[model samples]
Target: MSFDYDLFVIGGGSGGVRAARVAAQAGARVALAEESRYGGTCVIRGCVPKKLMVFASEYPGAMADAQAYGWTVHAGGFDWSAFHGKLEAELDRLEGVYRGILSGNNVTTFDARATLADAHTIELSTGERLSARHVLVAAGGHPVRPDIPGAELGIVSDDIFKLDALPRSILIVGGGYIACEFACILNGLGVQVTQYYRGAQILRGFDGEARGLVADEMIRSGVDLHLGTNVLGMARAEGGVRVTPTHGEEKVFGAVMFATGRVPNTAGMGLEAAGVELGRNGEIVVDDYSQSTVPSIYAIGDVTDRVNLTPVAIREGMAFVETVIKGNPTPVDHALIPTAIFTQPEMGTVGLSEEEARDQEPVEVYAASFKPMQQSFAGRDDRVLMKLIVSRETRKVLGCHIVAPGAGEMIQLAGIAVKMGATKEDFDHTVAVHPTMSEEIVTMSAPVRTG
Candidate 1:
């Protein structure tokens, strides 16, 4: 069974890169191909750049808080060009690092796209065909615009980073994390941000009380959010993007961005033609071990539509290498992964939601909501929440959710405890960190309500 290479990885995303690198390190002949940037969506257009924007957006509030703390701090208008220049440079460094990782590990790298020609052969856009013992599809996804007249006029999350300058105003059209995070980002940068979501609330899958508080804070922070509203259509107009909403008068803005959803990047990849099963969204269908129906073909990361997080993708890649390359069968653990949403009042959560836990079994919920000393001393009305969903019978912490400043950091540590199956008594036994918002998680003595 001699092949051109032991592995030909399609799509140089976090997952594919990891698989290629690790497999090569394990003495396999591995090669990877990417059509675009080496770092894929997360490093290039996603969390990395978005987190930088989040940091940039937070400066205004920090300055205001400084003023409230009696420091003579003054701020000026945000210079989008300056920040964007640095952002691009940092991304370039990261992309180069990813490239180095592949080459350093002795994995042949291709700057062109690759597709499955068969269970064992890969066709490249560079007019080269190669065969491999295994093929890994890690091609990520692209943000999609809603179907409507003049939809083309609306940009996507990818376009945000490429903007020459920040728009004076933006009409964001989705309630997902991307839309809401950008709404907060652009609003903080002094953009007249108006968001429309046809849903009843933003952050639909999160805890109800947490999302409700976030919605309240978003409104208080001046995002013109219109729930149960959608854009009927969009067209270029005098100001920027003329949008006709499902429920309101037509208005114009400097730009309209759609963050509705993303479709997997398996189109025209010859997956199904080669007898690879695909889901409704064109994602490659894979088993727990990331093996496709065609045993020689495998998929991971967003292309497989699994966990879809960069860390999860990396884990899937590691598991694939363990199973196939090392000859040790391994399955990815998809449970209890923690996530953070960079909204105005950030969200950090792990495990099941209160609503979800309630549906499964009897649970006790311990929660605290109050203004922290820092924000309170600044005279801001902002408040934070800490909550735990505990199983009534097993006494295990079923879920932990936090909505506050640095909730992401808090949740990462809290997630460790939850992942270890810590119970309420375990948390209760822990002492509180005095004067800190997270201390509430430990200090809450009684369940606010038990189901």
Candidate 2:
């Protein structure tokens, strides 16, 4: 069939942009449309800005630690205006880079929302209708505030980057990674941060011991964390925002932010009319190959709700291009993904949790909790944890979880070994790096508990 393009990509997110570029590079005609910024969530309002905030928030402690090291380091208060300005500039540059990549790849771009006009046609908000041989929906997701009275008074994670000034005190709601990370980030940035989670503990899906240490550390680090507590309502008061909780009386805070949850961005996109099956959360339903019920259409990224991380979305995009454009079949792999949480004390984890591993097989748990040399030497009471979950029958490391300052960096290397199916013996065979926290991974000889 004669079509205007071989691929019409909706939502110029990391996934959509990648698919469009790869398809075009493979000698296929490609067009992409995005209603918002080119760099999408991760670059524009998510991981990039959040990481910068994490870095900015760490300077105070770094300065204090420096002083303990006998280095005279003078410090000034965090200037929100300055840091936010730089963050905006960096986002602008990144967005430009994304645009440049698409243009350089000879992919047509439209700065307008694109919705499915049919199985193989896209209707742009600009009153343009284009037909393609295949359509790729890579629309991402957005954070949602919980349903409650005066919930509008509370901001989501997106609104954090937009605040002109950081509030003196914030009542944060939710206990997921976003909530925990922001709880840590705002606390470090010198905000009087109080977090409420209805659950019994924070970081629900992570290893129990690891999350336990995180919660304990968060409490010790001066976070007013209230687990098994939830906000009933919110209202504006003379002070700031008045919050009513299930467990406590009304309290006032400078702001109320909801890191409660996120939903896929799939509404009003004409996806239903075009025969694309959507999941319970309005997420597009796709198979292992990312192909929607409609053969001509495919979905990726958070829009599919299949591993919502940015890198996973990019990989899904690559797989889509390889399968559809390059005549190579590739199914998106969503297993054993290593993830890092940017909490006050960072967390990095991969594979199954000890609880999860034990549920499937007999396992040995090896764990250590101690104050690291650097922070201990600085007289900071902060402690770090290293844990390994090994399959008793196979002697393979089923899981590796680390809660330390650089756990994110440590996890990436550990992830490589775990991905390669490294056994507990394989780790023991490696030489330990002296005086390093990570050496604990290799130095632990005996299983602390074999079940």
Candidate 3:
């Protein structure tokens, strides 16, 4: 109605909503705009819903383990339609909670898409112009569809959540985390899964050993991995799709999924009209403090292409509010941000990888791979892989990498110490809690750090 707020936030995703609510709580008049659901990508389509499906897909594997634990699964079935319905229902519930949280904090919510009119003003698609002292853009990201003859025949990550039924067979394209996670999920659920990644290894940025272990594990789970491969085209076939590979043979499957990567949702936002600077990748260019080239405008989250994780965006939003609104200067440190892979035998790592750490300084790598003690009794073949990268001279633990069950939970605590510059001796001297998988971090006998 009026262009009089202290702060106007565009894109009510994880970052936008957080900034709006916090700024409003500090007595700033804040208005937030979202064209879609309130919870943004993570809560609606990206993280929450995807993770629920990952958990659901793990049940088939868990049932196999049940026999080892003296439990019988006489008869079982996976109802794809039921699972899809439940996921959608849960997302709807979360979207409402997100809206309530913002509203409860006195942040006004507008159900409209916003386009920049100028540095200090935005005009919604409905012709409502809103002006404010500061504007924060957190529109999030969208999956990319690589240009191919029959690209339209395949599905992107976003469409998978809306599928009415899971396919009996799936051919996944791309080698990034999304593709790998989906491969594991579908394969574990008893789908014939095939992954086509362009790189020689699936996760090119991770350590060679870690990537190798992940590939091994995926193969063990019956995933057909095609590395250093390219998808040439796709075509509708009899009851399925025919996918042609660039350097290989053609394959047919019931479904084709492309998990290439995500790009910023900055297009059509009228950013050019306001002279906002964008990077070559179409990401909003922001300074260390999250301020855009136009000082009055700011950007955060996947929109900026700087560490696309949801938590990183939340912290960046808070940093911007504290520094710009509250007069408390806070600069976010991007280093050592922990990330996790939800695939079977998940990966969790903080700080540098062994390769990256070695590049900066002389390093020693301490690693362990062992079948879990539970497996010794249950007769399960799962194993855990852990690694610690330390400076050869200083003996400071620079990185921690893990591939195992509960790796995500375990690395979070270790991330704090690593962030604080913990040394190898610190991990060694700390008394470990015995008879727990977690204690392995502190109690591993004989220092593995090498000179």
Candidate 4:
């Protein structure tokens, strides 16, 4: 078949960009289209910017720690204008790099939205039609506000990156990592943060102990977290927003933000019209190799609604390229993927949660929670948690969960051991790193409880 390109990729997010770049480098003619920014969610509005905010928010506490450690430190108020400018500049640089990667690999780029016109064709927002032997969709996803009265007056996570200034006080809605992370971030930035979750607890699917510690730390750090509560409605007030909680009196705040949830960005993309099967959530359904119902069409990343992380998407993209272009027929592995949530105390987990592990088979849990040397010396009441879930029969470590300052960094190395099927005996055999919080992971010889 005579086609304009061998591959036509829709969406310039991490997955789509990686696929396009690699396929083009492998000597296949490829083209990609992005409606908005090149770096997509992660670099533009998500992990990248949010991490920077996390860093910014920690300085206040760091300065206090410095004073306690005998170093004279004085910190001033946060200047949102200055930080926001630098953040935008960094995003611009990253977008340029993504564009460079695609163009450098000889993958044609279009700064317009692309949709499936047919099994082997794409229609761009610019009224241009292109045909390809194969098409890949990786449009990512977007945060959605619930259907509530005055919901329009509230902002989503994306709007956080574009704010002119940080509010003096803000109400964050939702109980997921996004809600908890932002609540901590804003609280650290000296905002009077109030968070409301309809659920009994925040971070519902994570390790219960880990999330419990996080919630406690959040409350200690001055976040007015309200459990079993929700915003019945919101309206504009003289100062900012007037929120009426389901169980509390109405209150006014500088702003209200909803971190509710995200949906796949598949609407109006012409996927269903082109015979692509979609889930009830509007995500494109794909086989193990990311091939859609239509032979020539494929979807990956958030649009597939499978493991919606950037690294996972990149892995899926590489697998797609291997299967279609290299004829290797690789399937992306979705199991045992490590994840980190940047909450106040932070959380790093891999394998299974305590609840999940217990449900499967006989398991033993070894956990330790204590005030770390660093925070203890700094006169901070913060504590760290290290937990390991072991299979009773095989003695293999089923999961590793850490809740502390460097939990994210620690989990990466621990994840390797768990991924390699390291046993509890193997961890106990290793020498502990003294004067470190992570040493607890290796030193715990006996299970705290077995079930």
Candidate 5:
């Protein structure tokens, strides 16, 4: 049957926007609706603003390093208002760009929320009903506060970007990257930061050695990190948030932020009503091609709870376009993704963790941890780590993990090699670029440990 549009996309995040734009460009009539800002989490609240804060938070340490380098640098207090003003402006510009992209692609845009009226129809918040031949759900996810007394007193990751002023002290709860990263960011910004993780170690799924180093560095850098600890309850006190932990005495802080976990944003979207399958976590269940149980309905990105990274979402969107519009039947690849956690020391990892590698097959680990020249000369006690996990029988590099400054940038390049299935000999054959932290990746000749 003919419909009003070939595709109606619910959500304007990176994935939805890209899918809508690409499909429209392929000559399919398209429409996209967003309840909030256009750029979605990554650009509007998640990565972009957080990274800017990461940069803003590093100035104090940069000033100290500047002095060590014989430059006369006078560091001043952080002006959150000024930095936040500029941040908002940049976000506004980005949102406009996203809008421009949709408009330029000839896709109809709606500023209101959209939900499924049926498998082939969408109902917008504005009482407008539209039908489409295919429906794409990319509604994304949201950070949720834990179920505890006075939980409302605490804020989530999104609330971090909206604070009018930085807290003098914050008790950040959670051991995930978001919790650890913000703890480091606030500490760097001259705030008294205390982090509590219920788990034995932070970054639970990452390489044990890498996360251990990060936890140690965070403590060394003045973050009051308490492992195997959790907040039992909270109360609004005269000064700030009075927190009672599972193992510690009650204490007060200017704020308490919870990075406990995130859940799919699928509430009231009528997925179940339309016969779309959802996971226990409210995530839309989808096939490899991002097609939901309903043939005409599909989901991608965080909504599908598959590789929730922004780049992954964008890739899924592209794959969706290729499969649906281009008739290429492309499947989204969710393997060997390289990721960078912007903690104090930073971590970049790709492929299996050492623990995972050892569990699956016999492996050799080549590792080195030493003070880098720049940080050493600056009189900093900071040390960098480079490690490779290689399959013993296959001689293939199973994983590469780096912990140091610029690990993010280094991992991006390293990821390419690992993605190509580079072997130990392949890495060994490459000449080392001396006086570089990453050269260690190529120059490590012997296994520190083999299993």
Candidate 6:
């Protein structure tokens, strides 16, 4: 009746660590396996390192803006090698912290990859086998490379942070957040940056107006955006890489980066041996409670194709412990999860877009667009846009989206309100915060309902 462990978790990323720690805290014996550093993509490459570069890239603008405030600087320069050094040091410190947290919780850590040997057993790369009452896989995902004629000439997200030296010019492919954000960062860092997206606009899934405004702003800030262009392939050329698109001119750059998409890292994990179902994208198929086809098995986070954000993964992991281990029967509510993109001007949103609202309910859209107050003094031409979508019948707020400085910080409050079913009237009734970018949400002018 006693199992080798209470829970065996594969992949010590956000979700796996959270699940292991929570289960262990609840007095369950837990074992966790990770092949690489504990913090996974967010802490190592995808989010954390990318945002750090974004932060570093913004200083030039900040220094320029400081001049308007009567600040003077003699000399300024950016050294890519120095930035890389700091980034690596910080990442190493973080990896140690992740390892400490797991070990401190008494969750046994195995520095090896794991494959499902059977329904109840996991075979480790070290030739060790472990059995548990339940098995949880949160293996996460990896960036994908498209099959082009000379695709190997280009790099993906995994290689972006590892660049030895910054390129003089870079060509970024795809319209996702990674492409958009990196384009802004490199452009701000004085690199001649060109971005290519097959769609008419960047940020395909965002609100139309917001997407348009972001693309326009990025272009104004010196990003050459080539929209509706298909990349044919890439090849090594005279000075660097030559990228040829289907409908556009051939562009040459010091480096090429493809931020196309990511697929779950479920291959060779022996899911078939365990009888677990998988989606077409290779994501683990799980029900509402994150339980796989086999009740004794569970999956969470990007591996499960749920919300791929780190916070959502952590929530799902904790929820799993509460439901499966503690018998509390917790189910995750995925609706209205707030997300932020750390591009130049930044953006944040929760709930549904106006287009999505129309598919579900009659929506009353309220929107406000204006130059931020800082622009009044700093003389910057950029503007901030905020929109609120409300249900016509119920008057409940259906969505909130914004583009500006502090958009991410502001959206969290709105996310909490939306999660609690706050109505349009409730937002209007709330007093506006004075002289703040966020006040625009509560004080938006009444919009004409097209429906």
Angstrom error at residue 24, model 2: 1.2
Clashing pairs in 6: none
Decoy 4 TM-score against native: 0.99
lDDT of 5 by residue, 1-451 (tens): 8899999998999999999999999999999999999999999989999999999988888888889999999767899999999999999999999999999999999999998988998999999999999999999999999999999999999999899999999999999999999999999998999999999999999999999999999999999999999988999898999999999789999999999999999999999999999999999999999999999999999999978899999999999999998899999998899999999899999999999999999999999999999889899999889999999999999999999988999999999999999999999999999879999999998999999
Instruction: Give the alpha carbon lDDT tens digit for every residue of 52-160 in model 2.
Output: 9999989999999999999999987889999999999999999999999999999999999998878988888999999999999988999998889999999999999
What TM-score would every model get versus the actual structure? 0.99, 0.99, 0.97, 0.99, 0.99, 0.98
Candidate 2 vs candidate 6, lDDT winner: 2
Candidate 3 residues lying further than 4 Å off, grouped into runs, are: 1-3, 445-451
Q: List the residue pairs that clash in candidate 4.
A: none
What are the per-residue Cα lDDT tens digits for candidate 3 across 235-273?
A: 999869999998769878999999998899999898867
lDDT of the candidates, in the order given: 0.93, 0.93, 0.87, 0.94, 0.94, 0.89
Which sequence of candidate numbers ranks them by lDDT, best first? 5, 4, 2, 1, 6, 3
Instruction: Give each prediction's root-mean-square deviation over alpha carbons.
Output: 0.8, 0.8, 1.7, 0.7, 0.7, 1.2
Model 6: residue 229 alpha-carbon error in angstroms: 0.7
**lDDT for model 1:** 0.93
Compared to the true structure, candidate 2 yields what TM-score? 0.99
Superior candidate under TM-score, 3 versus 5: 5
- Candidate 5, residue 66: CA error in Å? 0.8
Location of the lowest summed lDDT over 10 successive residues in candidate 6: 442-451
Candidate 4 steric clashes: 0
